[model samples]
Target: MDFHLTPDEQAFRDEVRAFLDELLPPGRHPSDPEFLSTWQRRVREKRWVGFSWPREVGGGGGSIMQQVILKEEMAKRRAPALGTCFMGLAWVGPAIIEYGTEAQKQRFIPDILDGKVQWCTGYSEPGSGSDLASLQCRAVRDGDHYVVSGQKIWTSIAMWSQWMILLVRSDPAAQGKHDGITCLLVEMDSPGLTVRPIRNMSGTSIFAEVFLDDVRVPIEQRLGAEGEGWKVTVSALAHERSSIAEVEGLLRKLDELVELARASTKNGRPALDDDGIRRRIARFETRIAAMRMNGMRFLTKQLKGEPLGADTSINKLHRAALEIEMGDLALEIQGSDGALEKEIDGGRWQRFALSWPEVVIGGGTPNIQRNIIAERVLGLPKD
Candidate 1:
């Protein structure tokens, strides 16, 4: 199969690159909360956040390959990955398009694209992380509203989000763990809702502990059909895996590592001059190339209107592993300085070392990805 971009696509890629050149910040800034906010504002001005989405819902309505091109070019330029509106654009927006009502889309999509509303995901509960189907957060219907009561942990950017896309247990006695679940679009400012920041080892409060004490959501806020949350969640996970934003971010990290290796020294010579270091970097480059090809293949499938399936688990696993490996290589190049605290010289290497753990753990654990590969890809029997 041909894997190259067409002439028109290439022209579009160049156009996107030129646009990014004008839009992205000039100097290097660490991926901190403040930087992210600034990046989001810039993205809003340029209208680059939802390039893959349809125009009717406040997007550019570009093809999936065009979206990939946009992300690849952005990453190649070291543009910021996590903008302020990422949760809304990357996860919540797609979920709404797939499962939201016409009224819901009209009400929320414009605000999302305009950067007037930010969304945070409410999937992982205090008791459910990887085993998300076991979430016990309950939402009982009360007249025209649902009284939601439960807590979600590791909610990213909850402090800044105006709305949330949540998964809750609407029925307790369903036959399967996946049954009786419902997805809801909730206003974060609703009564009885609380968001408390959870500080990470990196000395940043990016994630939060969210509490819902009888938070009332209107019946219309329910996404998909009641008791169909598992289906909705599966679709959401597919979107998450297919996210160009994350893949682009990983590619950018790889590029940054290459630059670091070229500049840093080891044994009285440039680190890139060392055979071992070169081999390691070469291996990572190969892996990243494979990842790019895989991502393109996925995008091609999307363009053909094929369903995104178990194969996405492979993309998630490979991308996550490659990211961690890139970080490891960077830390190796930094040598002793890699262990220094962030306060010491901004802890560049140390921050990467500290941040590595969450890369595998955040979206879904590596083991979970393996399980998906085993069960879905290999058709292996479950324990």
Candidate 2:
């Protein structure tokens, strides 16, 4: 694939552009809170904050092309999120360093690389979304503690997580629906959970619903055993398709939809001097350079160890149709000031076209990534 960069990955991309030019020095504003706690304590004293998780779990054991050049130089400086423990550094600390317990990696990998807490993901319910293994939520077990009871819905940041990673059903007669499920780690105050939130349509409650009632948990916060929760959710959805390193947040939303089509205006002037808006922004930069060469051919078959699966649903169905065609061409170049919110890019491309459910139904949708590329990458046949 020889996608260049290998003088030690161009000196690790010049040591991440000299630490973002000395800790975010351009026009400042890395979102402040004491400048993001001094840029998360200078990238957590250079461990580069979970840089690629492995150095005895606190992470930054780099390389995977230096974690794709430190997330493409922190998404070309949109910065802010190296680690605030969002979904506990995505995919619950690599599904607790691959199915936890060594005291769940000394109790949750040093508070998820020191961002303290916050993590949510229960795995859809309300009669299962995208047939998430027909989840029922149950739990049961008991004696050493298990109880649980149903309900999850949407979840994401479950009204400000404290911990979750759930998914239940403990063994309802085991037969199938990915067999008896079960993978815990709960907490959020436990005593019969609750949550609620859910707003969406971009009004944003960042999703929620939860519930539970007989909660409990304990048995050292179960994570692997009991019918192996669909093999710990198929090894945490195969390390969450390395979230195709969000192709640097869709190349910083196509450079803010090309500076909102050069300060928008059509028929009479600019709209990037239209040629059908520069052929739909050059077909969204050729489908974001074919999703960065299909994420570097799945990082060169994960650096040759191979075994990558369903070809990351072919870049998650080409990033859910290039984020709904670049949020409907940024509200069709803001025609009616894109349904106003005091326009001029203020409506934020009409709230990113009403934030399509974390991209047309989070994690799995676009018809379940085209049925995982028509039955596991085209072997086909499974109707």
Candidate 3:
């Protein structure tokens, strides 16, 4: 497939860049705690939150290619990502469009696009992580609502979110594991809903533990037909893959590492002068380039309306592994200073190293991705 962008698409890229140049905060760090609100406001101001969505849904109604261009430009600048709403705008929004009733769309779509409401995924529980279908969160039908009661762990940004797209067990017992599941749109303010932050090595509360105790959700809040949560989840995962769009950011980090190495001293000489360091940088650069190409291929398939399949797992696995490797290199370059808790002249690398674990475990574990590749891509037998 041809990899070049048409002139029109190139112009679109420039437009996105200029818009971001004006919209982005004067200075921001990817690790900043308040970065989410700042970036969310800018997205609202630019009206660029839902780039590829339909105009009727409070979006730009732009093409998929335009969306890809927007992500690339944002990454090139190393600007903070659009925050945890990535899932809301890309996955939940699209899912609602496909499966929600007209009233649901009218209520949620505008709030999502305007950044008035942030959302979190309530899929993983203490007992269920990769085996999501075996979730135990129960939702029993009451008079005018479903009374939900369970605990969700590792919910990203749930503490600050206004809503949660949750997967709960509507039927306690069914023939198959995937049966009896239902997707529910739950308001954070609902009675009996509580959020507790979980602190990570980065010294930040990036994820949370969400508790539901007889929380009532209206019948209309259900996303699709009952017992079809598996379908909704699969569709959400597809959108998750499309929205990751972080390959360019990874490349930019690699570029920063190169400059860091050039300036870093190792045994009275620049780290770039060290043979081992040079080789490591070269390998990272090569892998990052391959990742960019892989991302482009994924985008092309998406443009052609082809299914993403297990290839998304491949991308996730590679990208997560590379992030850890880059973090490792950063730590090595900093030597003893890498272990520092706060920013010293050269100690901030420790933060990068500490944050690597989250990237690996966040979207899906590497082992889980491998399982998907084995069963779906290679057509291997399941254990």
Candidate 4:
């Protein structure tokens, strides 16, 4: 793909930069709640929240290149997120746009873009362990509703989300494990639904164990046709795994890691002066640059209208390991102070190290990504 932008693309890039200049001027505090609220409102008005979704569904209908330009500009300015609903904006919105009914689109897409509600995913189970086809959560049809009864584990933000995009086994006896699965958009407050927050090593409870005991879901709330959830899940996971915004986040984290090294000490000198530390930092920079190039490659395929698939597992695998490594190195630079939760850098590195599950195991584990890449991308036989 050509690296140079077309005249229209250049114009869009300039527009994004100008907008950032107006909203994120010099000396502006990026983390102020009021400023972030205003920032979200301004960007939503400009239709940048769901920039690539269709205009009919309350999106900007921007080109892929234009969306990339928008994120690049926002990250450069260290601006607030485009909107407040993390899961909704990331994959749930895209999944709904691609597979939801017209009524579903009207009901959810607008709220998601407006950040009016939070959404949690109900994919993992106690034993599924990334083999999503093996999910055992059951939903039985009863007239105009399905009575769902099962448990979901590792559901992020379940304690606070207003809704969930859930998967249930509608026909367990189907010939193939992947078949007979169904997806539903369920209200979190529905009767018989329960959420139990699970505190992590980081002393946070962002993840929870969710229970559904004969929860009645109206037929109208079903996301797609019955027994077609695997297809929708594949699409959603692809979106979750492949994000250009993630590259920008890693870049920001790299900058922080560099500063942490400068402020740290090892062998009576600045840690940044240590030959080993310098080499590791250089490797990180080089790896991040390569990831950026790979992102552009994926963008090129998207521009050709090619749908993303298993190839995204490559980046997912890389990011999972890279995050853990970076976190560990940060703690190492801090030496013994790393053990204190309130020590240098406000214990951010320690928290990052302890919070590996969110990044390393959320979408899918590194081992799972390796399996997908080896079997689906490389055409290797399953073990």
Each candidate: how many clashes?
0, 1, 0, 0
Task: Rank candidates, TM-score, best first.
Answer: 4, 3, 1, 2
lDDT of 3 by residue, 145-195 (tens): 999999999998898898999999999888899999999999999999999
In order, the Cα lDDT scores of the candidates are 0.80, 0.81, 0.82, 0.88
TM-score of 3: 0.91
Ranking by lDDT: 4, 3, 2, 1
Segments of candidate 4 deviating more than 4 angstroms: none
| Candidate 1 local lDDT, residue 137 | 92
**Per-residue alpha-carbon lDDT of model 4 for 31-104, expressed as tens digits?**
98889889999999999888877898888998778888888878878888888888898889999889998889
lDDT tens digits, residue span 1-383, model 1: 88678999999988887767665657746366676676777666556667667777867777767767777677667676524467777778888888899998999887877778779889998889989999999999999999999999999889999999999999998999999999998999999999999989878788899999999999999999999998987777666635456666666676778788888899999998999998887887777677667777777777788876766777678777776777777777888877656533477766776676566688788898889889887899986
Query: Worst lDDT window (10 residues) for model 3?
Result: 339-348
Let me know the TM-score candidate 4 reaches against the reference structure: 0.96
Structural similarity to truth (TM-score) of each candidate: 0.88, 0.34, 0.91, 0.96
Q: How many backbone clashes does candidate 3 have?
A: 0
Of 3 and 4, the candidate ahead on lDDT is 4
| Predicted structure 1, TM vs. truth | 0.88
Better of 1 and 3 by lDDT: 3
